[model samples]
Target: MIKRSILAAGLATALFVAPAFADDRPPTPEERAQIEAVLAAEGFTSWDEIEWDDDGHWEVDDAVGPDGRQYDLKLDASFAIIARDPD
Candidate 1:
């Protein structure tokens, strides 16, 4: 039982600490392009600007659609599409 507890503690520590030293790299150029392409394909046209919000989220503004309707695209750190407007 003691051995199991020790092993569990070590595993938990490793799980918590490992991600701290992990890469903090930003998205690659290819990834950016892919994300842009996906947005464009979804009818977003004018990708005027992108900014990070205070909550550590990203907001892509001025994303106009083919029909000329503007939209706001929000994404998380992993570039995962979080929400869309004009639903």
Candidate 2:
């Protein structure tokens, strides 16, 4: 009984957390370009560092902007510009 209860609790926790970890939003063209630019400036030179966040948003790690500053830009799924400097 205790094992079953623990399993059920774990399942319940997973169910609640799964969606929170899911990325359902899509990126827009401008947002894509911005992300790419950041990646390029950061010496990524590839698509390896670009990825979607759990909220269906996009993100690029160690990205450098045109201003020569490094940051992590977060974009909404719609590709709309969202948050910047997440960390």
Candidate 3:
């Protein structure tokens, strides 16, 4: 019974936590176009990954900026740069 309870608790936690990491996949074609245009306008020449986060934001990883340095960027739903972190 103790083992079963532990298993159930773990499963419950996973179920609840999963939504926080939802939409882990890449953007659709139209979404990609918009994202790419925004990146280009912001002087991001290249990016390694783009994740549509559960909070309706875009998480761009390994983005090469205008200064030719890698950065991690967070963009809001409107594709406006919200935060930038050096990678």
Candidate 4:
């Protein structure tokens, strides 16, 4: 029935979109240390915020580098730096 189809479609949409709406959360202490180790290796002196995204990526909101410049960083699940945006 059309009603059943509509309900199924709604349920399917919710399942597909749930991850996209996942909360951005602070990294766990262990996760933070891992992320910090990566930052250190990349010459980032400090970071203001680090979030573990639902998409399996890490986001550094404000990372200060050795050169005293701030950068926004994106890292893959493996902790490899994938993108850097300087401000």
C-alpha positional error of residue 16 in candidate 3 after TM-score superposition, expressed in Å:
7.3
> Considering only N, C-alpha and C atoms within 3 Å, which residue pairs clash in candidate 2?
25-77, 26-77, 27-79, 28-79
lDDT of each: 0.72, 0.62, 0.89, 0.90
Query: CA lDDT of 47 in candidate 4?
Result: 85
Task: Please state the error at residue 77 of candidate 4 in Å.
Answer: 0.7
Residue-by-residue lDDT tens digits, candidate 4, 1-87: 999999999999999999776968888899888999999998999888899877778999889988999999999988899999997
TM-score for each candidate, following the candidate numbering: 0.50, 0.44, 0.71, 0.71
Indicate the worst ten consecutive residues by lDDT in candidate 3.
18-27
- The better-scoring model by TM-score among 1 and 4 is 4
Which one wins on TM-score? 3
With a 3 Å backbone cut-off (N, CA, C), the pairs that clash in candidate 1 are none
- Residue 67 lDDT, candidate 1, scale 0-100: 78
Task: Estimate, for each residue in 8-84, the C-alpha lDDT of model 2 and write its tens digit.
Answer: 99999999998875654444677668766555655644332567766456876655555655666665655444665
- Write out the backbone clash pairs for model 3: none
Model 2 worst lDDT run, 10 consecutive residues: 39-48
> Which prediction has more favorable lDDT, 1 or 3?
3
Clashes of 2: 4
